[model samples]
Target: MAGAQRSEGVVTVVGSIHVDFFIRVPRLPRPGETIKGHGFAIKPGGKGANQAVGCGRLGLPTFMVGRLGRDFSELLLNNFRSNRVSTDYVYVDEETNTGVAFILLSDEGENMIAFDPGADYRLAPDDVKRAESVISRSSVLLTQLEVPLETVETALSLAKEKGVTTILNPAPARELPCSLLRRADVVTPNRVEAFMLTGVEVRDVKTAVEAGRKLLSMGAGSAVITMGGEGAVVVTSEDAYFVPAVRVKPVDTTGAGDAFNAGLAFGLAQGLPLVEAARLGCVIAALKVTKFGAQEGLPWREELEEYLRKGVLELTTPTRV
Candidate 1:
């Protein structure tokens, strides 16, 4: 509990940075087939960047630590500044270009995305070490896999050594070393990623329980398995609870996970229980998908609180799974 407190209420995000190019399509084309898109928009995004901005919008003191290419450094830095996120630790790589993600949003709100992880993948462990003071002062340290795994491990290790809570959002899921998982205070994975990490199908609440349990057994302190419309499951050795998602119409689902993570981080920093934090995360994500784009749809603190008061208070309390 005391480990969740920081002098300045800061959240440190160490991972990738990317510029997202999004296009609206009638439907996703089959592989090797070409189709015309309806509209296009370019925006600032990367799981790390999006989550950092989401935290900042929640009125948290957010710091971003990652590498950007010289070409897009100003663009991404300005975006971070506008979002109220600190980019003091962000580095500009002269050799590699900034990372980019191409996302196709279908009319059904489904999306297909691919990435070019240029400067994002170039962050080294020593780079994380250079930001020691920032990480040491953070209430929560959040990271993902878009960057090098070694860099992620280094950050996690440092956070653990400093008694800071650490969250690992294992996107682009892959098998991980036990040592890394053991250091995480929470591991937030989507249904697909949970299945990949544990070999358990998470199509519904029951299977999500199985997968979350399995992930915890693998050494994580806790597992928060997000199942989109089905809501999320918070699992640990002692209990498994289901936190329902708020119902909302979808526009673009690209940033929902990022929003969810940010809410969870904000709640944790505020010392809320794990289930309540997950509840806040689900509420934030549901509201985010009602608009388009990643960072563009994130809610400010007052907006999120108002929505929770009116739209989410009547939902069933978190139920034991």
Candidate 2:
């Protein structure tokens, strides 16, 4: 595994880690219905890990801070190593099993997921405190809500105290307090999660802009509401714009949001303006959905650069709202 380095542009991820079990079916089964699946595979996953890998693959120095079960500790750690993510702050819980997600992926690339948050729930505020140095020295701190809420709060608070850029990916939608939201420099939430946080149904660019403004009013420095194929809406106190998604035939939409978050964080850490960072995120997400598996689909730095060099897909500038 890569050793945690105290670098100027390090991106530290404070979140959950999990092992995912996938079942490929023609369609998702209805409640209490039994169906035969065509394929099965196990892979390393979790919002935190997915984003961390995405950042690392983009050639950023990334560190992961979270918990794993003793049962899957080596499996996940090895994955971090292979992906070039530093595992210095990853903890292993002996009492609980590793977190797991059972996903049913349809031929249309839609997915339904059920999660067992085993050791992930055990990641406490104290663990965040122990990784405080990592967050303090980071150029960007990326986090998600899969771990305990208080833990996420602590990480954000510490990062804010150090003036580190913080990106919060609010997944598995839940309402959050303003105090926590205020600490985030950038908040990237999908349409559903945005609607949950702001009560503004984000069905189109206009509605997404409404939701983004609601997030800003709630205290986030900026809001990026991802609308999947329709692209994303970016809003700050001064500006609101829409970035279009790259056209692609999606094979699996899993982890596309994580990929977006990683690209956004990477762009921000490199000192790009907010809107440009969001444009980068859209490209990364569009690339991710064209392949299967969350981590497997993430594009490496060379691939992203080459994709841009080709100029086959023109990412339009953010349109003013």
Candidate 3:
């Protein structure tokens, strides 16, 4: 199915959009310490936008449902258009400023980031209310925590009402109500986020299963704990298994998660099983970390299929986490 024509369902991304300012340094600065940067660059990013880009680049029909400031609307819309992501539901708030992220990247590929959500947080329930039809018709509804929790909850609730598959990538970890978790068909959280949600440290496969169990107990139908280089573990009532990360020389780890989530949604849209979808996600993420920019590194459908056909052969095997 990798090279098949896209006559599948649409993926709707309801999340954040930001202009990322990246400063490269020899290493992260200490408190009250100033360091010279090797170089600097700016790019378009945000969990939601990156995921939408990922979906589009993978040859999936995708839509972005979020808020943007008037100042950055053109830039963001152009990005969506280039990626083939429909921007029909993107709201523009004239009174608010565009969102931005200040990132400090070390030469070793480690990163520290801070965000000013600005208009991203201004996405109200009313905004989502206007896109109810879009949400209802979607095959997969993907979202993150960059937007207001209320907005996320509203989107999740609507997806549930429509019986759409809901995937929640709980990033920038925060405590959430069980009502929200229960509605999610799948919750994909990185190590830090897993710890924040389940109070379980996810250092290896065993602990990842434990954390996943906690998430299931909290009401998520399934849980995926992404452990970066350690690989990812998926836990559900039917089965538990690990999907190894595709190893590559790392350049930048930014946007890896976004790419992974999009890959997951794309796989599901193609009617792949849950664990297989996540394996496809791992394939996309491995490609993402080998490049510098977030969206720039996302693979087109042909590129991804070629790589999947040639490399990462062992993804067919799933070991118990």
Candidate 4:
């Protein structure tokens, strides 16, 4: 395991940015069923933006690199500014509209989403190359699959070439090439995504371990399979263990995964061990679920530290599976 040696370098995030439309309902509607929503609000989102805000709020020097449409570009830019995330590499596309997500949130804290990727898909490898200086200087480069796969590949390849640690959060899961997996220092995927990636049903710790190992064999240096309330399974070349979730009553599940990924990246940038980083991720995700909305629920550095100081965040020994 690597020892802790905190770096002062920045954490660069290359992904999508979106304006989210949230609708709160009593329950998720069945297929072809009509339902009435009780609440509505608009917020800044996108896996990349959420993670960037999360990192910034946790006191990391964060930069966002992605494309936005002319329509909602200002909304997301202002959001980044307020959250202390730099928009140096954020571009505006005159042609396509910004990406938008329609989220149906249930009373049980579960959610269903549909999105039109819009200008998010227009993020090209050239845009990544334009941010080469920052990418090469980063201590940790975090990315997701919300944007173009080629752009993700380009950013990862460049970061790897510069010897930066790379974290890939494979959301909206899809089959990935081993070459892409090989460049990632860490790969984070929720249970559903783990199933999509490895064809293993990850219903329990045993299955999560199986799926995680498969990801390792496919070429990721480390695999963290997030199992929601069951915690996460961490697999590396040396060992595999399960980190128990921080028990909390959830108000909204949106962005919990992004919070986890952001926490993981922050820990790595601060030179913590993989297991410790994953533990931090669990704490962040737990805090995120206890509130409503995506970016709104993320805890600031002071809040997280205070939570830790209260001794409410207990980490049990990771059980080797």
In the range 38-114, model 3's lDDT, one tens digit per residue, is: 67998999999999999999988898988888777898889999999999989889998888999898888878899
RMSD of 4: 2.2
The global C-alpha lDDT for each of the candidates, from Candidate 1 onward, is 0.90, 0.91, 0.88, 0.91
Once fitted onto the true fold, the runs of candidate 1 whose alpha carbons sit more than 4 angstroms away are: 1-5
TM-score of each: 0.97, 0.96, 0.96, 0.97
Q: How many backbone clashes does candidate 2 have?
A: 0
- Candidate 4 global CA lDDT score: 0.91
Residue-level lDDT for 177 in candidate 3: 83
Candidate with more favorable, higher lDDT: 1 or 3: 1
How accurate locally is residue 250 in candidate 4, as Cα lDDT from 0 to 100? 91
Could you tell me which residue pairs clash in candidate 2? Answer: none
RMSD (CA, Å), each prediction: 1.4, 2.9, 3.0, 2.2
Go through the candidates in order and give the clash count of each: 0, 0, 0, 0
Q: Ten residues in a row with the worst lDDT in model 1?
A: 1-10
